[model samples]
Target: MLYPPLHHWLLGAVGEGRLNWLMLLLAAPVQFGPGLRFYRTGWAALRHRSPDMNTLVMLGTSAAFAYSLAVTLAPQLFPAGSRHVYFEASAVVITLILLGKLFEAIAKGRSSEAMRTLLQLQPATARVQRGAQVQEVPVDAVRLGDLVLVRSGERLPVDGEVVEGRSYVDESMLSGESVPVLKESGANVTGGTVNGTGAFTFRATGVGADMALSRIIRMVEDAQSSRPPIQGLADRVVADFVPLVLAIALVTFLAWLLVGGEAALTNALIHAVAVLIIACPCAMGLATPVSIMVGSGRAAQMGVLFRSGAALEELGEAQVVALDKTGTVTQGQPEVTDVFVDRGWSVVDGEQHLLRLAAAAEASSEHPLARAIERAAAPSPITRQPPSRRSLATAFAPSWTATRLRSARRGSWRG
Candidate 1:
């Protein structure tokens, strides 16, 4: 950090007191601008009878600034030859603290950016039907009971009930359905859904923040803002440590003054200020939370999440292991490769029977297993296309009817 020539230049400037005054000018803004913000916030906290880390920060930086100011203005008032300025100390400390806060704000923003991005996905405008006249207006202007028109290729601006026409709308955000949903008269559609190949007019039931997408965004924001059930030990320590730290700072100043009588007053004062600055406790306070946030974020990216700090601690202590098939032993996306039938069931045409039954039951569902069974029931071995629900119902109806007839015949003979 030391440049040889710059160091020599500083030594000369110190003797002449030129560089010292320049440092004072540099320290002024650091103390009064960003650093003064701490004082304002900390003072507000004190007025409400609740002081925190900000209070400690303000006291530390203030002590350093006051000492540096005294040293700069009156060199003769000090213990002769001990009149050194601490402008650099106070300035660097405050600036670094502010920089840390800037980075923390950015981190928090990124943590909840998903909500903002979702909010932005809704269309900006809507075609509203006010009696006979249809006009394009801002989505915000669309109100409850207003009829909003959506075309073949458009995003719905608000949650509404379809009043006229019919179309397929993609509602992946709400239902996680890959296929577009058919929306006819009386069908409900949500905001942010993409319209498929048809035109429709719907009555707005939920506009503005009342829409499903808006509620989802708010939900995500709240989840990110809520604290976990069990907080880290460090957070509890910091909560109780504030009052103790302030008391220690007062004791430090008085103890130094008593130890170094009158001749060492300047030395005593400088030592006291140094103690306060060193005892700011920012690193101790930030260490646990920062590490947890970063670690949790990384885990979430990998598709894993801990419910709380307590959960993470329990995970660290795990020695014995039992793999549950439902959650812990998944390949993430399940597939239907095999089927099991009970021993009492007839198996003469097991393959065909199972395929028909599965396809028939799953025909109305959009789940992957349903699609897989429907594909397996296709007549052609190479056909990859899924059968329609109507076709599946037609195909399975005859086989099921014959099985019921045979069962009835056996029951009549027994009776």
Candidate 2:
């Protein structure tokens, strides 16, 4: 492909004089542009007390440039035209190295879509209940203890407890569950989950960077920033390999000049530059970043977000998996299977009367228990009352009579 055969094309270009002037003209810009990034990165790694692939590519390409420059300007310094220029080899190596870097960047950009998706989940504004008045305001302007009112079809804008109403919340964005979970007063809700069925007012306990969704996003960003362990090996090899190859090439040229004369010296110098160009270490530098990008993108599709290269690497060796009980092990739903009351609290008439009162209290609510109550009371005669100030208050009051009145208002009361 474009990679494994790069060295052969480089060698061929040098053997033909097609690349000489072109190589000299393009060398500085290519070296300073794409090549310089590696050079600087390697230098930073070294200063940080670490070595990396850039260190090797930089040293090797620099050697090739110096040697080719020497042969180009002063042909007689080595032997009678014995020092041949391998300008094409240097140019081709730098070009291929840059291509590999571009590929790595493209791959990483693709993997970062997970972060973009997470950012898109945030709601821009929230309806806050300031006493009896509700106002739409910027989400960032919201604070802890603020009572945020979420209407049907609106996204919950902060992590908080449902304080004033009941609703079914679509929590798939945060929990990965497909069902709409019913939430009520004292139930916890997260920012970005969609409110379903009814309006609700929740106390804003978490906002800004402290929200659950924001924390998950931060974790993924941190994961993307972390370096994998295998990159260290490639770095060490590149660092030592570059200068060592240059020294060997120099020795090869001197040995050829002393033992085999002018013709052999020319061949040796060309081969020496070939060695530096062929061993540029671009592939080594590309290996880790490309794999990390591919792995992270695939993980996102699977709904398993990886926050770092180290986390993904660690998962590869994991022997056991831990799952949260609420959403993972059990269905996050409540069903009213049965109900009983103490003799003193029981209706004087019998079981049907108590059932009618309990079902009535929950009829107008969108809670899971309300749905179950409505379903269970289906056989009874029910009537829907007009919504009025008295009816709304009677629906939410704590007394049994009020409960019966609310159920009657919702048409769940049995005559």
Candidate 3:
């Protein structure tokens, strides 16, 4: 039978004069089965010199059991059969508390799985270039200065600096920005970002657990383990509340025996037991877990992932806001602002010359300034050698060449 039904049977027997060894034997499993873990965990916490809500429940339930056992076995020790035992009430309270804990465990397990999904995005293997040979190896085996190859549609496996070639990198996984970023030599690439439309070689700067994705995972994990202030308050209340309730119950029992006489003793004991069973901190214990589940699930749907209950709580209280200057506040894309020329420079001739110079200098660059130069020179038709054939002398002809070289860089632009 279920705990509630069995508890009713045991309670009825105890209320009448039929308390027996068989009833106690049957009730023992019902009391201890669901609650055994709480006792074990509470004992372990105490052994380790820590106290928790489990400790309060353990002490309260143990007190109830000991008192009821004394009353059941030896009624004369408690002013004849006038006063009553509430072993069933104690058992029911423990069962309810255990049920709450089971629900909490299930909720926490799902949250942990959400974090696991984030961790799984990190690629295990990376294509590394050693001298002139390229080989696929475990990402952890990659070291600093190793050249890692990333291709179109593949996730970058380590934080690195682009050393050869160019590609548009989709960094939405880390920055939440939708547009692809063009990366070339000296540009920083992060692990878990997708490469777009081009092949590139990058020098590894971070590997294994030191990668950007791993640090994000670590931040989430740390948030999950940290407790919020509300949880701390609930824990403090539970710690002292259980013992205070037990003391009240004791006083109630004594007051009934002394002031209200023997006839009122049974009624008074019943009231005390009822208070103990109803005031069990089950609802309070469940409060934080339920809020966390609902809040985290809502955040996931909105593309915001919280690493822990503490993070959720802190986010709710946050007032001062800091935004990344480039993407969060202003559009990261730059637009042409003005065109200025040296004194006595012809408007038409100077414009054409500046455009040519800008296009050539920025032909191999992937910076926002380079892209702006390319866009400004798009309408003009200009033929230039491929990036590989172009000498380094032509590529680094000062920042002014970007404006003049803009037209040549336009044809190769994909963004």
Quality of model 1 by C-alpha lDDT: 0.70
Best by TM-score: 2
Tens-digit lDDT track for model 3 on 1-415?
A: 2577876787686654465354456557866877777789877865765646776666666656655766668766555534455566667667666665565566556566766877777788999989889999998899988999988789998899998999888787788665578899999999989887689999999987888888887877776667767889887776567667768888877776677664666556655665555566656666676676677666666557666666788888788877654554335455556666566443456665566566666777655567777777777753353343344334334443565467457765221
Instruction: Sort the candidates on TM-score, descending order.
Output: 2, 3, 1
Tell me the lDDT of model 2 at 382: 42
Off by over 4 Å in 3: 1-26, 40-52, 63-88, 263-275, 314-415
**Candidate 1 per-residue C-alpha lDDT over 302-410 given as tens digits, one digit per residue, 9 for 90 to 100:** 5343434455546656898765334244443335567675555555665766677667666665444556677777652423344555554454554555665776888
Error of model 1, residue 314, in angstroms: 13
Greater-TM-score candidate between 1 and 3: 3
lDDT of 2 by residue, 66-138 (tens): 7777766665666644455555555566676666566656655655687788877889999887878888999
Return the lDDT, model 3, position 320: 89
- Residue 209 of model 2, lDDT score: 97
Clashes of 1: 0
The superposed Cα distance between candidate 1 and the true structure at residue 352, in angstroms, equals 15
